[model samples]
Target: MADNENFNSRRHVMRVAAGVGGAALAAGLGVLNAHAADSDGGRARRHGVRTYVLVHGTHSAGAFWTAIGRELALRGHRVVAVDQPLHGTERFVPAAYQTQDLRALATEPSPVAALTLDDFERRVTGVVRRAARLGGPVVLVGHSMGGVSLSRVGNAVPELLAHICYMAAFCPSRSMPSLNACAASPEGQHAITPLDQLVGDPEKLGVLRLNWRTSDRRDRAVFKEMICAGYSDVAFLRVLEGMQTDESMTAYDGRAVGRADTWGRIPRTYLRFGKDRTVATELQDRMIAEADALTPDNRFTVHSVPDAGHLGPEDPARVTEMLHGLRV
Candidate 1:
């Protein structure tokens, strides 16, 4: 039951984190246009290849990967970006209106809502199933808390992934809680504190909504820049409003304590983003260490993108090349 509770809480935090971006962030990034393929959406047809499931980090929705997905598609890879379940159902949390919802949760004073780990696992399993149907086994790529989600999934369904890549990811050590990975790392320690205050409860579904909360005016501006570049106020506010605190935080932080298992069962890769004020490089290495130690069979590869930060997909070419290199 304790394990169950931990899984549930952690999943909520990760899901909400993945669904962070609201309308403004999406629009500001022009994520739609950025991904417009230079080639026809159908370029070279490569079938029977592994599916790539791209997951975004905190304050970023699955739509954040649209550009990268299109690029991968053009290269003949079946790719999908999941719109996380942190904000409830799409009808209740439609893309356009999601920003408003995020704002309310972030600024509104309220109790945190919870989700069962079974429910979180079921949802992730569905995502894995969808990716499998799209292609074959999947190459799962996750950033920030998204990485934690992948860790949880990797433990539960190692067979679903052909490759698991963590980008500046947070990882739980053996017998340690997920929070330990963050606390021990320079970036994680700096990032979590202020963020914890804004949402009131880091374990709640409202945490994602408050990602933009920074007491320091300068830091807040920097956070905004790191989150989204070139956006209108309408879009920014929408993203702000659509935030939620994921229930998955428990699963993530708890992994550090009990030492979340299942690393040796699958193939893994690590993409360490550069200039990232969020999850720093040292933390990324720690995650790699934890992954390797958990599964002796798990091969860990690391790449550092010096130009990119937490938002590394801004350059589709670099990401495309990496995906191409992973081709089977």
Candidate 2:
């Protein structure tokens, strides 16, 4: 009679477990196993998984995170790459940029020109919220100019984040605005491509447009050197193909200095790209230092990806390893 009762109880537990989702079932089993182990006074193991929200940089879209996102997903992690307003396919271009047609322009009046940093923040924040619904708070990651949006989101919703990570990204402070921060750093002047290279007049069009299809070999060479030095010609062209032609100047006008009370409370990490030419190592360090100063009591935990460039998707293995190691 005792053996029959135990078998009936075990069968009932299995039926209940089968009704819940696989993750819930696994969690339930983990808890039961943990309780069994703790009968001997052992501690329970942490069981929750972290989600990541990746924000892209200037002239790029969420597709920029394709490689890295895939790798993270393969490692049993949740990933969401955000597409900033007026960037990538979201931009208002008359013709498709993939055609490599330099003549393409934004003839029609479009709202993309009016997009601001706040708009970007809102979009990213929405994505972060959705990611939070999936499991737990996210590890927000941003690259290059996208860091500005990430900072704004962190400031706006620090509670929804587990950790904020900047990869060769700009993390501005109250004292140092975005444009000013770039100008103040020695690497900013040395490593960046000149603004004069832009194709269209910002005053006339209200947007900064680049001719990614420019047939000028010199221009292509300079662009490659500035953004992706190690990429092959075909790979560089593919990157350009994925880029948007028009970008809102308003997005770059101000700094995204997060609030000390809110953003400061959240844990932060900075991954410096040692060989980054676009946002040089010196400039990256300056921004990191300024961010540290802003929240002196809760300074960022800094790391380095030696010889890494500004593009995160190019090197999946190293980025995946770094992200996998993050603990919240």
Candidate 3:
């Protein structure tokens, strides 16, 4: 009966409509955090301070979390933004690409192309294990495709994590696995034309590479609208500057299914990017709903930033407040 009551309560929370505006969100967050603090007394005693492990998405490295990591550190939290292997180290620019002369561009060779989802999971797990050795609470945070790695780590090592936070990221469900999540969806059909901007054929190159420095004004506009519409032009450029041209296609092929007994045991939060175009609002809701259904007893504590795009965390403060509010 108690389990039934908890499941019903979670269903109600998940069904509540989002897009309530910033002021309301702030108030809701305060209440949610207060409840967490009250209920997690033992957790607070066991782990006095929290360490955050920030994971980046595709085409980017740990540098993507520079602003957020700085903000977290200032708030008296230990933070580690992981640079996924081969992201900043490999270079393979095709001469035919429009941005061939851009010195910042790099692509993966065959060995780097061999990287899989397991490789990323291992990388994140290593960080979490290290943070645990210091005897403090650990929060694993992931953005965009980084959520895939985060979920795998959560499944593999839930005992080490105090919380797992997904920032407008892909949280796969039983019905829609990782590979399927990357496929076109009704909500994301018009979100972005990343394929239209592809510089090389993945089949031929053995990897996916993007020309981030494309000079086309239209391409830039589309890129911004889809991924970083909330960012200033200068800020968007900085993000592009930090992006890698190469990514292992195999990385996207595997599934990161969160298990009911393992991954579902950990506390989790989902921060909806209300204004996101890349992973459209509808799709985010769908993912949240699906995951909640998969693990009804461990439903996400959801929050929203009403005006945020996919790259909203570039501001850091938006996420800092949420992180600060989390008892874990």
Q: How does each model score on lDDT?
A: 0.52, 0.65, 0.67
Scanning candidate 2 in windows of ten residues, the lowest lDDT window is 23-32
Name the 10 consecutive residues with the lowest summed lDDT in model 1: 21-30
* Per-residue accuracy of model 1 over 1-328 as CA lDDT, tens digit each: 9967765655444333422211112312212211222242232224345567766554455665666777777766667665555532221232322353544544443222343334344556677876555435578777665665676677777766777777666655663345434544443443323232234335444333343433456645655554433435455455454444333433333342212345456667777766554665555666567666766564577777876655564556896778667733
TM-score of each: 0.67, 0.80, 0.80
Ranked by lDDT, the better of candidates 1 and 3 is 3
Candidate 1: where are CA atoms >4 Å away?
A: 1-46, 88-112, 116-118, 179-181, 184-187, 190-219, 225-262
Full ranking by TM-score: 3, 2, 1
In candidate 2, position 227 carries an lDDT of 73
TM-score quality measure for candidate 1:
0.67
Ordered list by lDDT, greatest first: 3, 2, 1
Alpha-carbon shift of residue 193 in model 1 (angstroms): 4.6
